[model samples]
Target: MAELPDWLRSIPPWAFVLGFVVLPALGFPISLFYLTVGAVFTDPALALAVALACMTANMAISFAVARLLSGPIHGLLHRRGYPLPQLTASTEWRTIVLLRASPLPWLMQSWLLALGGARFLPYMLVGAPVQSLVGAGMVLVGESLFQGNAVWLMMGVTAFLLGQAALTAVRRRLRRRGSAY
Candidate 1:
């Protein structure tokens, strides 16, 4: 396997933790952290927890920032011809889940949730778990791949595929039931 760069090796654990929590909110590619955190932290479970916590923190930060700049963001989107979703209490949960499940970037998801007027309670409740779970799986899969462990890699990929299948089933059911998210 390839060795981590000297600069990466020199970073302290605390700095890594802080970077994991802050950089994504600043529009850094979160997958860089998700995929490499295992190599830094060593312990898979601890790495998973740390990634989840950082992701949740990033979500909150993104939402707060989006709320603070809602007017400007709305104007920008309006100029770009993108219509914001109307998130009612009834649709907020599903919409939040769908957004989390979508392939959109982390910051975009949070911004949409906040700018679309999702309630704080449902946003955290539905958004955090869904994003965290998907992110944690990425960490696990990444860890196994980096470690060259075929079994764990297969398990992670299988679990991810199953999760995607379940999500697709849920989407179909909602569509069949005429639930507008």
Candidate 2:
């Protein structure tokens, strides 16, 4: 793995965390790509840090996408005279929480939420942990692969997928119940 610059190494953990939470929101895919690479090649501690950073970045991007869609996207749809319902109204906290917890694609979830008007803070709060878990799992999978433990690597991937599936099911159940209220 390429060593980070002295400047980056000198950055405090809190600053790294904040940067992770902000840059991705600004649509910088390079940060996510670099973090993924770091997670793949670095030691576990560094890999974990990279994974967390990437996940944080993802959450920020998701929140931004959701917020933007809430306004401009809504305006565009209205201007087109489409029969679509107001997407902004569907972006309730409960919906965002459920989506964050579910197995649906992250980018898709972010786009939908943004178009639906979910608030940034709530989305970030709900998404950060979930994304972190996913990112950490990815790092672990890479480590297992590097160790030439194909069996263990496969197991890790399977477990990750299964956990995501289970979470998605639970989120669906919660959504159904919430909607019934």
TM-score of 1: 0.89
Worst 10 residues of 1 by lDDT: 1-10
> Candidate 1: misplaced stretches above 4 Å?
5-7, 75-83
- Candidate lDDT scores, in order, read 0.81, 0.59
TM-score of each candidate structure, all chains considered together:
0.89, 0.60
For model 1 the local lDDT of residue 102 reads 88
Which candidate gets the maximum TM-score versus the true structure?
1
Off by over 4 Å in 2: 1-41, 65-70, 81-93, 101-105, 150-155, 158-162, 165-169, 172-181
Model 2 lDDT, residue 117, Cα: 55
Q: When superposed on Cα atoms, how far off is each prediction in RMSD?
A: 2.1, 5.9
Error of model 1, residue 131, in angstroms: 1.2
